[model samples]
Target: MIVVISGLIFYFVIRRIRKQIDEMAEVLEDIKNGNGNRRILSETHEIVAPLAYEMNDIITSYENRLSAFRETEENNRQLMTSLSHDVRTPLTTLIGYLDAAQKGIVTGRDKDDYIETARRKAHDLKDYIDVLFDWFKLNSDEFAITMNQVEAVELTRDILIDWIPIFEDKQIDYSIDIPEQPFRVNLDSDAYLRILNNLIQNVISHSHADKIGISLSKQNDKIAILVRDNGIGIGKEDLKHIFERLYKCDKGRSEKGSGLGLSIAYQLVEKMHGSITAESEQGRGTVFQVLFPLAD
Candidate 1:
């Protein structure tokens, strides 16, 4: 009688194990048919529980990777479309101005004006291409950052010095307040300079501001650098996407830019283990803050 009872117990255990195996097979089939969401529903005490957990983890990773691939594809499509339109439109206008001047359609001062317009449009095209190159280079795997300990205040001063003349030329009032005590950070000096230059360029080109302010301060272990402008500020909706690649506010749509400057700056900051944030109110002003941990 004991032997018979043991045989019965063995049969029941095999039957339950077979059931779980069948379920796992079904889930595999579903996944093969492109149903990435299908998962095995098995109790922790079941024979197949470990296998189920591992398979589920694999599926989750697969799904995440696939989603990322799709997003990247979409972004590439949008970038190409934007590039086509931007390049062609400016090229066409540039050709029109040059053609008018070449064909003598306008004479005297009008001809000179046409030539000047063509020159400006040419410069605009070059600027757009330069920005596009910068974006591509920064995204490429070959790009490298050479980080070293640098004095933040001195670096900021050097960067702003070049911009002083530009601010004067633009007739934009500006102030610089860098503390005498140096705050040091680990950074690629060129990348840091690019970040500052990009922010200042954005203000010069798009902010429509007459006054600008730059200040640097240290609090505890972190250093803060602020770039503020009294310009036509960003709208709430547009501000949310200002850092997105190729994003442009409605107010800046007519402006000549590849819309990649701030995005590149953001990427560079991340690579340097720093953070950047923007604050703005429409018709009031915009301020960009960059922070980094002090070098040990």
Candidate 2:
């Protein structure tokens, strides 16, 4: 009788194991058929429970990555389409202006005006292309960053000195507050400068603010730089996506930008082991804060 009981128990265990194996196989087949959401669910008391949990975690991870990849692909496609349209429009106008000037369609002041318009458009085109190149280089694997320890306050002051003339020319009131104490930081100077320049450029181009303030200070072991503009503040919805590549806040097609400035700045900050954030209220103002670890 005891032999018979043992035989029955063994038989039941084998059947249970087989059933679990079949279930797992079906789940895998579903996944293979493109149902990444499929997962194995097993009771904790079962011997296969641990394996099922692990497999489920793997599937979840795979699905998340796949979703992200698909989103990125879609974004790239949109960027290409937008860039083509943006490039063609200005390019066509530029050619028309130049052609008219050459053909003597208009003379004297009219010709000069056409030439000037063409020149401005040409500069805009160059700016767009430059932004495109920067974005492409930043996204690629081979982009190099040279790190070094430098005095942060002096570096910032030197950089802003050049911008003072531009600010004055624009008639935009500006202030710079850099403490006399020198603070050192490990950073790629070129990248850091580019990051700051991009932020300032964004403000000049987009934010129609009359007042701009830049301040530098040290907190604990971090250095903080703030660029604040009292201009047309960013909308709540647009603020969330400002750092996404090719995302533009201004809705109209007439708005001229490659929409990669903030994205490139964000990436450069990361490359230099720093962080950047933007805060804004509609019609109130916008402030961008960047932080880096202070070099000992």
> For all candidates, what are the clash counts?
0, 0
lDDT of 2 at 122: 99
lDDT of 1 at 78: 82
Give the residue spans of candidate 2 off by over 4 A: 250-254
TM-score of each model, in listed order: 0.89, 0.88
Cα lDDT tens digits, model 1, 200-247, are: 889888998999999999977999999999989999999999899988
The top-ranked prediction according to lDDT is: 2
The lDDT for every candidate, in the order shown, is 0.90, 0.90
